[model samples]
Target: MAVITHDSAVRRQLRSGLICAVVSATSFGLSGPLARGLMNAGWSSASVVAVRVLVAAAVLVPIAAAQLRGDWNLLRRNASLITAYGLVAVSGTQLAYFNAVAHMEVGVALLIEYTAPIAVVGWLWLRHSQRPTVTTVVGAALGITGLILVIDLRSGLTTSWVGIAWALAAMIGAAAYFVLSAHGDGSLPGTVLAAGGLLTGGLVLLAAGAIGIVPLHATTNPVVFQDFTIAWWPPVLVLGTVTAALAYVSGIAATRLLGSRLASFTALLEVLAALTFAWTLLGEAPRPIQLLGGALILIGVIVVRRGELATPDAPDRA
Candidate 1:
């Protein structure tokens, strides 16, 4: 075996970290579209999420075990936070987004879920006494405005209350993930937390399905499948492996490297990416309003990035 140099090791770590971040974003961005596709094929939101989480847990468990080998003690100490992170953060986000797309369009659900960054900033300000700069405030405003424009909230309110509610729920779940994950000590690698969290969330979903909290039978059963929406194994595998497992793993890596603020801000890119994917895959042409909303969202991200760079404390999520 060749001996590793310090610089070589550092470079390798950096490269690995960057790849993780990109993969995480890509996985997350694809989730909305895939869920929408699956649902259209006759699957229910509960079934889709339950299967995705269960599969993700299976893939992530071994990897997390490797990371937590000597660190089992940390898992017990942070059990509450870890469980909450998985349940609220991982499961909540997935279920909510899936439900939202079941009613509204994928782009609309994403526009709402992407609002988590601002919520995170607000939480830091109110709870931890972190002050927001002018740029941060503007970014928040812009993001909200863009979201409203993209989803045409006023029209949607009259159209479908369930869809709107599901999207908002997704935002809450996404925000929980951001806050809880950031608060954890850097000692626990995100991969381990993600594994534990996905496992917990999957269990919760499974239990909920068994007890009839969610109609998993309807979604998972073949009767739900139709001509337009077949239970294709390829898409399901992609959803479980890359989107769930790789996405969470990479997102945490980005958080570790770019800092939660920058990482979260960069994550907003998913909205645009999702829109692009929908357009290409499903041939869903966006309206003019969507175009404008997408532009504003991009601008808001730029403003947030600028403020994050200016505020030293913002980068230090812990």
Candidate 2:
């Protein structure tokens, strides 16, 4: 009876984690399209991400405070982790991705950033001595092949080198997020982590802007979405509420429940979601070749998940 109860509990947690993961992915997938809408209307990448983080922080910090219940020591213990997450995972990733969307199509840029799983495999081998298997290598190859197709070298159009570089940076940031968001070692509560990170990221971005390190240029020009122009704040509002606040909190919660490895595997769905949103929101229809490449990337991600199952770094879902 005890074993059955344990199994039932595990299953329930798994189901909840999956639901959270899906919510996070779909919400995150909307970010690029919405930010692109703003960028098209003269909003700088830094500005878009800054406002997004700041607004999300405003909404989440109170909830996080309640969750803390005045346990100041918990924050002191996890200060560095939260700060790092805020800078790299939240601000840096969003800034870079917004810049990528400014230069290239949303789907293409997101697909490039989605290659972070391959980078994680390499990181583990070098940093943790977790040598990857043949399966991972094959997956990496497929991913690279798909990336080439996604780049569409045969199209003869001048590809944006800057966009690709920015997307690669976002990929690194995402890899950092996957590594840092694990719930092992009794880290900060998921709500606290997400909220604190957003606050830190927002402040850092604002400081950088104040000092002229990053541009804060923005326009009040209406943003064009699909076939109509709408007030700018509406999409920006959604960017904060749905994408950053809801997505980050749920993603961290899912990671805590599902473990980083499985959580990241679930996050592969973001690529599909991004493509779908881009197609529907921005009319950025993906080419057939790009769709094929996307399939390859998904398959490669699946292969990476298979490799993760046997690796020591993937902690058991707790």
Clashes of each: 1, 0
Tens-digit per-residue lDDT, 1-318, candidate 2? 997997688768778987898899889889989989999999988999899989999999899899889999999988988988999998788778867877877657766787776666666567666677777677666766666665565544447999999999999999777777764475477878889999998998898889876789999999998988899999989999999999998998777776655566567767667778999989999889878977886786567556554554444322
**After TM-score superposition, what is the CA distance of residue 140 in candidate 2 from its true location, in Å?**
5.0
Candidate 2 overall lDDT versus native: 0.79
Q: Write the per-residue lDDT of candidate 1 for residues 1-318, one digit (tens) a residue.
A: 244685466456546654665577767778767777777767777877778877888999998888888777888888987788878887777777777877987656767787777777767778767777899778767866766666655444334679989999999888777666666658887878888899999888888778876778434422222234445565677778988888887787766665555566667667666667677666676678877877887787678767765675443454
TM-score result, candidate 1:
0.80
lDDT of 1 at 284: 72
Best by lDDT: 2
Cα RMSDs of all predictions?
5.5, 3.9
Model 2 compared with the native: what TM-score? 0.81
Residue 237 accuracy (lDDT) in model 2: 92
Instruction: Looking at model 1, report the run of 10 residues with the lowest lDDT sum.
Output: 218-227
